[model samples]
Target: MHDDRHAPRKGAIPTHALKAAQEIVVLKWRRTSFKRLDGSIDVLDDDWSLSIGGRSLARIYLLNGGPQDGRWAWFVQVFPEGTPGNGGVGVDDDGRAAREACESLLPPAIQQALADGRKSETN
Candidate 1:
């Protein structure tokens, strides 16, 4: 709804900020490899995924170019479906916000895990 929270990725589904069932939100993050212009693979530090129970739910990345270069972006996906468009673009600041913003789209376990002092470590 807000222009600042646009997902912008192709196949990104439009979602109305809903929290998924709590138990279904045991999320994890995994680093991703990117193919460089020279065809070399680079494991980026600013790009990673948001997973639930080891399955990918979305990706959080830093924009490489354009007016918003260096801004963090949220790329969400629903299994057997597509991605989320502008679901949580600029929810927070422009950097590292997706990591927090995307939480609203999923279960409350993320916060609960924190509250319980059991935050999942990045893998």
Candidate 2:
């Protein structure tokens, strides 16, 4: 019998190179508007992927609100690398991917805002 724990899971890709690239692949979709308690909201469909260590490490999906004009929700997927059975870090990895993807999808001005947020957190 195969020990699933020891076996490398499918779809696992090394992400070191992709992370080093510092460039993300961005996919954009049409925007949608909705009503919110606070006000009206617009959501955009944007997806992004990061390559690391010559492999694809993670992918992100962004849904940002308009009217409010900010991020409302995000979806992220992380592939396995350097881990047994291609396990995933789920919430943390997804959150990071989402944030990064969202930034990639933003306009120049909004992208600046995302960058600033990152800087503030680090400092």
Candidate 3:
């Protein structure tokens, strides 16, 4: 009796929030694996989201399942302001909205690094 939904089997990794923006969110999650009498397979699917002023900004879907060390994972899609083509709400007013969102999520060190990178690129 194996419950795939809530049960914690082997190779199951916990999901955690890593970064977020007004329209985007990044998350870190662990991969899961299962073994049966016939063979074994890996299951790696996770979801994340971002919010702004109590409103959801974006949704992130991740997939993490593969052979080898099992550390290989990938981000499947990043839905900003909900699903596209559905009249989704986004910060089209000014690019500042996006920049502010990014700043809020990123740490001071990372922000400085990004700023320096941008400066170097321009110079």
Candidate maximizing lDDT:
1
Rank ordering of all candidates by TM-score, starting from the highest: 1, 2, 3
Order of the predicted models by lDDT, top scorer first: 1, 2, 3
The residue ranges of model 1 lying beyond 4 angstroms of the native Cα positions read: 1-27, 34-42, 79-92, 109-123
- Residue 3 error for model 1, in Å? 37
Q: Where does candidate 1 clash, by residue pair? A: 6-86, 7-86, 11-83, 12-83, 12-84, 12-85, 13-83, 13-84
lDDT of 1 by residue, 1-123 (tens): 467454534543323222332344343466877679999999988778765443456678787787777778785555222243333334234645687666555434344543333343443
Best by TM-score: 1
lDDT of 2 by residue, 1-123 (tens): 766895645654333433433343332222333458889775534544433343333344444455423333443234223322322322223445555554444334334434554565678
Clashes in candidate 1: how many?
Answer: 8
In every candidate, how many clashes are there? 8, 11, 1
Candidate with the larger TM-score of 1 and 3: 1
| Candidate 3 residue pairs in clash (backbone atoms < 3 Å) | 13-30
Model 2's TM-score against the true structure: 0.29
| lDDT on C-alpha atoms for all candidate structures | 0.53, 0.40, 0.34
Off by over 4 Å in 2: 14-48, 53-56, 59-69, 79-123
Write the residue-wise lDDT of candidate 3 on 9-112 in tens digits: 33222112112321132222223334567786645354334333233333333324434222222221222222212222323223344344434443333344
